[model samples]
Every structure is written in C-alpha cells, then in structure tokens.
Target: MELWMGFYLVSFLNIARCVPESSYTVHLNKLSFEKAQNYCKPGSFLTNIPNEKEMAKILKTIWDENSKTDTSFWIGLKKDKGICVEQHLTLKGFHWTVDNSTQSDFKTWKVEPPVTCAILRCGLLSVEYSHSGAKSNGFMDTTCRNEHAFICKRNIQLECPRPEILSSHDMIEPKNDPYTREIVCRSGARFNLTCSKDLVWTVAGNENVDISQLCLECNKGYRRDASGNCADVDECKESKPCEHECQNTEGSYKCLHSYNGNDINEPPQPPTTTLKNRGNSVQTQPTSPPDDVRTNETVLHIDESAGDISNIVVPAIIALLIFIVLLVIVAAIVKGCLRRRSIKLARRKAEAVALNGSSSMEKVNEKEET
Candidate 1:
C-alpha cells in the first residue's frame, strides 16, 4: 500500500480559548473507501464522521479547501450487521468508531432506512447548497464499489509556541482578567476554564449545555501539578496505597505484596485427608501439603525469628550489666585490702625504732658510770 504524509494547521476557537492545532491533509483524489484506507499514512486511516458536529466540521473543511466540485466523500462508516457500523467497529454490542482523532456515536442521517441490508454498506457525506446559497450537509449510505473523493484522518500532536500560565492555576481569575491573552497549549491538552458572567463555555454550535455550572473542569483523577499543568495523580507516590509494594500506573496503582517469595494475593488452601473405617481398622489417607506449612502469606504478621532474637538479646544485655557490676565490686575490695596492709607496715616500723633507741641509751649510761 502507498503511504502519504502531510501536515496542516487548523485554528480551534471555542468560547473561552483560541488554540492552534495540527491536522492531517485531506486527500482530494477520488478513490473508493477501501482504496482510501490503503492510501492513508502509516498511522492514519479513512476519515470517520461519527457525529453531526464533526460532520459539519468535515463539510466546512471540504468546502473551504476544494471549491471545484460538491461531490460526496467517503467516510469510515460501514454496515456491519443489521445496523450501520463505523469503520467495521463494534464493542460489547455498541456501534461506534474511533478514528485517529475523535470518537463519537452521533449520526446526521437525512432519512432513516426502512430496512438495512448488505447492498447499502459504506457511508457517504456531502455538502449541498440550497437555492439561497445556504449550505446543507448530511450523511447517506451507498455501496462500496463506487469511487469518490475521500478524507484521510490521523492524530496530530501540536505544541504551542509559549504559554504563560498563572502561578496559582486558578481559572476563574484568569478568565475574568483583562490582561489574559491567548494561551498556547500542546495538542490534546486540557485546561479548566470558567465563565465570568452569564456566557457558558460550550461547543460553538452545540446548544444543549448546562449554563449553571459556569465552569468547565478537567476530567476526574487529574489535578494541577507543581508546574501548573493538569496531570493524573500518581496514586503510589501520593497515597502509598499498598501495604508492602505499590506500583504507579496511569491514573491508578497496582498493589503488590509478597510473603517471602510468593507474590500472589492469596495462598492456595491446603488439602484435608479423611480417615475411613474398614470394619475393624481405620486407614488414614495422604492428602496435599500440611496447612501449617502451606500458608506463606505472613506480610502483616511478625516474624518468629525477630521474637527469638529479642528473647535472647534482652537476657544477654542484663547478664553483661550484672557482670560489670560484680567486676567493679571485686576491684574495690582488692583496693581496700592493699590499703590496710600498708597501714600495718608503717606502725611496725615506728615501734621498732622506739625499742632500738632505748637500748642505745642504756649502753651509753653504763659507759659513763665506768
């Protein structure tokens, strides 16, 4: 299949904002629905016109670009069952199609078919001009054999030039501020916008909007981050959802817990054996693993080894403290014994000196009498 790549800039102006968006080029060549699907880019396919609003947009696009003819263009819708299908798509008994750009269940058929059949399979859209030159557009079904100009659609990711967002990320103040300018945003970027007075923020041509809300909030599970950008909350980091292990996912978290090496949420139950009576004796039948040893999920339970260690460590610490106290008492007793022995030796030396001095004095007095 041949592949074609082209880029175009489309202006997206809603009630509260003006955004510059990137889009794929519409193939002006004439081809059937199957051929149009084949000629689309690698990541693209035949354009899908699912709803009235998108149908109007596609009609406007064709009228603005190709002024040569007002021929019908083939869309991605096709007849799958008794009902019309969009791009041969079905899910859970629902009829819809998601092109690279948008998804919708809206159909703008000029007249409802009395009975649907295989002959009317593919869908066709055209922009017809009235007698007063007013444009009228609608969708119709036809066979897939006919050739017509078709539109190819693919997703476009456009980054804004540069945007100046408020520090607080409050939409109310900015929507009413006079200095607010056109804020550039990337493709598919969402923002919270609020209305100042009575004007409601809705699609350009859509009238069934609730004006009482006054604010178009971002989708649930998304909030402003530190960078003032709306992003999904990382439940793992924000709330620590898991008891042991938590893995962050896009808008959710995977709670993971393991007991030893087993990661399953619940352990397998142990089998039970029954004793059968054989008239005079009872026989025990072997079963699966024992229940006491089979259950390994002990994540929230305390470890027996930890209790054993504490049981041994606390007594050891007390014994060591007692030993130190006994060693200190023994050292004090030895010091007291040595002090008493030194005092006894000093007293003996003094007594011996006094006795020796008396004997010398007696000898000297006898020598003087002679």
Candidate 2:
C-alpha cells in the first residue's frame, strides 16, 4: 500500500511538472536613453552586463520574427563609479572580484569591463530562486544609443481539475451536417475525442465543419478558373489595362511605365552610318560625286590655310620660339655671372682702402709723438 501511494505521488508530480508556470511578454517601444529604464516594469531590473546565454536567447527570439526595427534597450549591469577593475573568470565559471570600492559589496558590474563613471544602459532578466521566490538581476552596459524591445516574465501556476472516466454510450453525436460528424461528452466525462482523419474541426453554433471551405476565395487580381486552380490574372488582356508594358506575376501583375519621360517600347537608336569596307567585293559605279560631298570638299579647301598653320607652320614657329628662348636664357646667365664678379671686386677694393687709410693715420700719429 505504501509503494502504491508513492507511485500515485510520483505520477501527480510528473503531471504538475509538464504544465508551464511562467509566461514572458516583450514590449516593443521607443524610449530615450534614461527613459528606457522606465519602460520596464518597476520591480523588474535591467542588465548591468549581459551573459552569453541570456544574450543568445534574446537575439534568437528577436531575429526569429524577422523584424526590421532598429533599437537597443538598457541592461542591468553598470560600470562602478571611480573603480578601475579588470575581472577574470576561472574554469568553474567563477570570476575573481577586483576591489571596486571599500564600502559597496554588491558586485553588480557591467560584465568583464573595468568600473567607470560612463552611464550605460542595461538589460534585466527575472530569476526565480528555489528559496527566494522571485528576484531581479543587475544590468550590463551594451552598445550605446541602440534601441531594443524588452521582455517581461511572470509566474503563473495552473491548477487542472481531476479527470473522471465516463461510459462509452454517454457520448452525444450532434446532428448538424450530414457529411461531417462530432462526438461530445455529456458533462462529467473527460474532454477527449479521437478522429480517424487528422484534420482539425471547430464547433460553431452546433455546426460541424471540415474547415477547408471557410478559406477565402482568390480576389480579382488572382485567377480562380473553372477547375478551382489559382493562377495569375493578366490585367493587360483586359481593355488596355496598362498605358505601357504589363507583366504578370503569381496572383498579380505589374504595369511598366517610364518615369523619365521615355516610351517603354520605343528606345532611342544611334544614328545610322554607311559601312565602307576598303576591299569589298561588291561596288557600285558612281555616275557622279554627290552634291553634299562636293560641298564638303569646298568647305575643307576654305580652311586649308588654317589647317596648314596647325600642321606645318605651327611646328616650325614653335621650334623657332624655342631657339629664341634658349638664347635669352644663355644671355641672362652670362650677365648674372658678370654682375656677381663686379660686386665681389667692389667689396674687396672698399676693404683694402679702409685698411690703408687706418695704417697711414697710425704712422702720422707716431711721427707727431716722436
């Protein structure tokens, strides 16, 4: 009897364990730097630093929905003020605490970063300890000025009623549609039914539906032909639907029109030119040169003098000008050398005259003294 009681208790615990107790709800919003902390529930905390496991879970949930919104939120971890600390973790996943402050013992630092005064945002995770019931962790500093939605968690325990077995004949078959059928229990029996087919059925006002008919039919842009096959509805076939070109896609069609004032079908073409192969087999004997060709030759002859200046006279004139420039440069160099020599000679003569005058003045002074 004791063994049977233990078995019943074990079964009860197993059933309870299978039921979920907590539900998480995330809030998507835009908040300012300081106001992001306010967006979370008051008792809930933000991250001072984010752990790898927590970060991975948060990223997986956000990316699973393929959201295009760009935002970051605050975490609980923060760099401690005035304390420059570097922490290293051991093999047992325990991190050595560096001295942050003499008084403060709460080691809630933005993870793996030295303590500083830069105010950073943190993410909060709610943890339920076995003995402590519920508590919030400190925040971590993530990238600044990024916006992200925050998740909130609450514990909710569900109590399911005891199940009672009923007789087979106690089931009632509701008479609704002749094609579909439903088996429902009369009050006290366990709410369970087995269907041969895997299709899901929902009860609405005593009607049994296979659920496939309630699906919406294809609209005007989509084609649902006689055999109930869906295809693209070609709008172009219907009375000049597009002003330009039209292309059909699955269930819809697009009209192609040029935005830059161009016709869709008619593109601009290059000017045509006659291809003249110098050694071609076929040749037409010209009766006379065209009037246009003769006019072109006359125009070419009128500019012959200018053409001669550009081809021959211009090159000769450039050579002559180069020779004159060379001569002028040589003359200037010779004149500069001569001017430098004259300046040097004048400086030497001035020095010598001063020295000779000083000597004569000294000799005359000595003679007068004697």
Q: Residue 351's C-alpha lDDT in candidate 2? A: 67
Candidate 1 lDDT score at position 124: 66
Choose the strongest candidate by TM-score. 1
Q: Judged by lDDT, which candidate is best?
A: 1
TM-score of every candidate: 0.31, 0.25
* Residue range 1-370, candidate 1, lDDT tens digits: 1222222122222433533232334667788777876776444556665555665566566666745464677777665555433334321122223333334665446534335333446666666754333253555666778888877665333121222342223232243332223222332233333221122332222334332222234456566432334578777787765666766665555665565676457555455576767576666565777556534322322335534578888999999999999999999999999999778756655665577676655554464458
Give model 2's TM-score versus the native structure.
0.25
lDDT of each: 0.52, 0.42
**Quality of model 1 by C-alpha lDDT:** 0.52
User: Compared with the true structure, what per-residue lDDT tens digits does model 2 show for residues 288-337?
Assistant: 44555321111111223444457887889999999999999999999999
Worst 10 residues of 2 by lDDT: 294-303
> What's the distance in Å from true for residue 303, model 2?
99
Predicted structure 2: lDDT: 0.42
> What are the clash counts of all predictions, listed in order?
0, 39
